[model samples]
Target: MSSRTTDGRSAATTAALLAGPIVMTAGMAATPWESENEITAYQAALAASPDQTQIAAVLLFFGYALMGLAFLSVLRRAGGAPRALRIPAATLAFCGATMLPGLVVVDFYDLALIQSLPAEQAAAVGERAGDYGLQPVMQVPAVAGLLLGGILVMLCAWRSGLVGGWAPALVAAGLVASFAVFSGVTMVAGASCSVVAYGGIALRLRSARIPSSPPAARPATA
Candidate 1:
């Protein structure tokens, strides 16, 4: 594999590895969403159909955190590519940073929900009881940040011509998917981010691997 390809793969793999804890931290940080708003429509859905809601939430957070890290890694890889690199990288970074604050809010909301719950309901859920509460204002920004970030990253991939490759496409697809999945809640944004994050990881991998030679254009001498 070419050095560029090698570097990209190494970076992406590293990002994926790093994403593990970030996802976990995000999950650990996010328990409050369900706990705090168990009665809300968003949480109510989960309450009614926890298998989908709970599992999807866990996957969404884990994916979102990983994508954030992956996007960051891609930007770092592009550091030497061109001045335009900053646009997407910055967008990704900004979105990731913006989303970070919501973690605190989610936790607080969870705590609030748990405190407000009646003893019976709280006890029924047992371990998850501590998560109940009303959501905080920060939820808005978190969702917005992810949506905006996903859009920005999509533009970045397109502009950078990274979209020509599978990696870029994956990132772009994930970001868009997130927009759909995260429709009503911050989790939709989170899901979109995760898809993009994995895409970024794929790009990183591509950057590090040896790509096959592009087809040569035939001569126009005739």
Candidate 2:
């Protein structure tokens, strides 16, 4: 494809990636409860409005899938880095992205179990699910993937001059801040920074002029 067409594709990918965060935010908003005690409340709410929980779970699943796409696109845009940096970043990002959808699945299962089982059985199953299910197994690693992968991507972008100015720094800072407070607000802050960083990358790639092939090296003097 022509350079112009390639740039357009990259810009479109970035735009689609932007939707990931928005969808995730919407999923969060649609969530029925904030705490374990609230699970009972959620059960009550679900009885009155049967579809809401399912809809929220589906939305979360799509959000995570979009996040995976956005992450992979960012890695593609950061291509040409040293293998040492590139490999780990890609691996970690991939692990996180792959596991994200699983989280939503586990959550939905938990909701369904609660809805379908007796209270005693539901509680027992929930505890076992947390202790034995794939969700807990993958949660920490997925978190590590996003955090480490994001840091590596920022570093690679800075090194390659693919992204300059304050955007990379802001992205890195936001990622760090998410861990610092470990709150919902911090999560939103981190996601916002990511959006800004990716948006900046999209604009840069869209506007960049394609470089022609370098002239052949000169012969050495006798």
Poorly placed runs, candidate 2 (over 4 Å): 1-7, 33-52, 117-121, 133-136, 165-169, 172-183, 209-222
For all predicted structures, in order, the TM-scores are 0.48, 0.70
Instruction: Look at candidate 1 and tell me the lDDT of residue 215.
Output: 75
Among these predicted structures, which one has the highest lDDT?
A: 2
Error of 2 at 181 (Å): 4.2
RMSD of 2: 6.5
- State the lDDT of candidate 1 residue by residue for 50-101, as single tens digits: 3444444564455555656555654554444455656745664566554653
TM-score of 2: 0.70
Report how far residue 11 has shifted in candidate 1, in Å: 6.5
